[model samples]
Target: ARDGILVVRPDSGELPKIVLDVLESLAGKFGTSNTPTGHKLLPPKIRVIQGDGIDINSLEMILKTMTAAGWAADNLAFGSGGALLQKLHRDTQKCAFKCSYAVVNGEGVDVVKDPITDPGKKSKKGRLSLEKNADGTWSTITEGKGDPAKDQLVRIFLNGDLTVDEKFQTIRDRSNVGL
Candidate 1:
């Protein structure tokens, strides 16, 4: 790093221990300095990227441990894989689908799941559409409300047939990170 080459990776073992050991070792060898906020920072060319066995809690714990060890948060970078795939924000929220609205005997019924004891079970009523507002932020417009023409929801399947298809690269390019 002193010569401006950065190539460090930590893939196995206990994440926090490995990260702490590597950082301390680097600091001892190349030295460190305190940032304006008093966080210890290592030389710019040398750093560690923890890639394996990384979960949300482990990531937070690693950062906290780094902070407690007087190391700056920027000294480490993270790669996402099984940890991200297995533990996602959607899983934490316990997301589920319920019939929030239905047409019974030609009568529109606003159905909602609300338990008297658990407010967390409460859900929106009517239909939903993901649309982008004029301000350029995407939002879930409920109650069968939204400009049908500009709706972001794509009709990928219809009547037991897949209507929309694209190459893997095309799909990947359409992700949020792509734009």
Candidate 2:
């Protein structure tokens, strides 16, 4: 689940008892601490690994074991989302984006995707909203418009898992500079 991936094969590696110990410890602190949470334990998406490229055969074995334990081996449900996120970090640079805002009386929350105009001009501790246009193009909200002064938020649905560089890019913060 960390490095390359543990495929849904019948021969995933032994899973190493150490990994199990870590999972168990994590389970005790979060959620029900059940096997499911253990299985989903991730080392803070920012963590890094060595040269442990995943092997198809080894992944198969792990999947088999997970299945025997009554847990679905589906990628989306189990480790797929995180794996996909990791791949994105390894491949490109993007982060999930979210912006929240509130509208004043007689006005609506101004949502904007254009960093320079909306988020850039405003403070850096909130969310942004994306408005759906008739033509489908996104517009950065400046002044309160549209809805009647309601709070709205927006965030990019990044892949989730991200590499160091990808994480930096995904943030899309002021440090990046120049929008």
- Candidate number with greatest lDDT: 1
Off by over 4 Å in 2: 1-18, 33-53, 70-179
Candidate lDDT scores, in order, read: 0.77, 0.38
Question: Which tens-of-lDDT digit does each residue in 1-179 have in candidate 2?
Answer: 45554322211223532223333344355422124544443323221121122345435655565445433333212233334335333213434444545456856564534433234333323333345455745444544444423323333344464333446556667345443
Top-TM-score structure, candidate number: 1
Of candidate 1, the 10-residue stretch with the lowest lDDT total is 86-95
Candidate 2's TM-score: 0.23
- The lDDT, on a scale of 0 to 1, for candidate 2 is 0.38
Error of 2 at 110 (Å): 48
Root-mean-square deviation (CA) per prediction? 17.7, 16.8
Q: Estimate each model's TM-score.
A: 0.45, 0.23
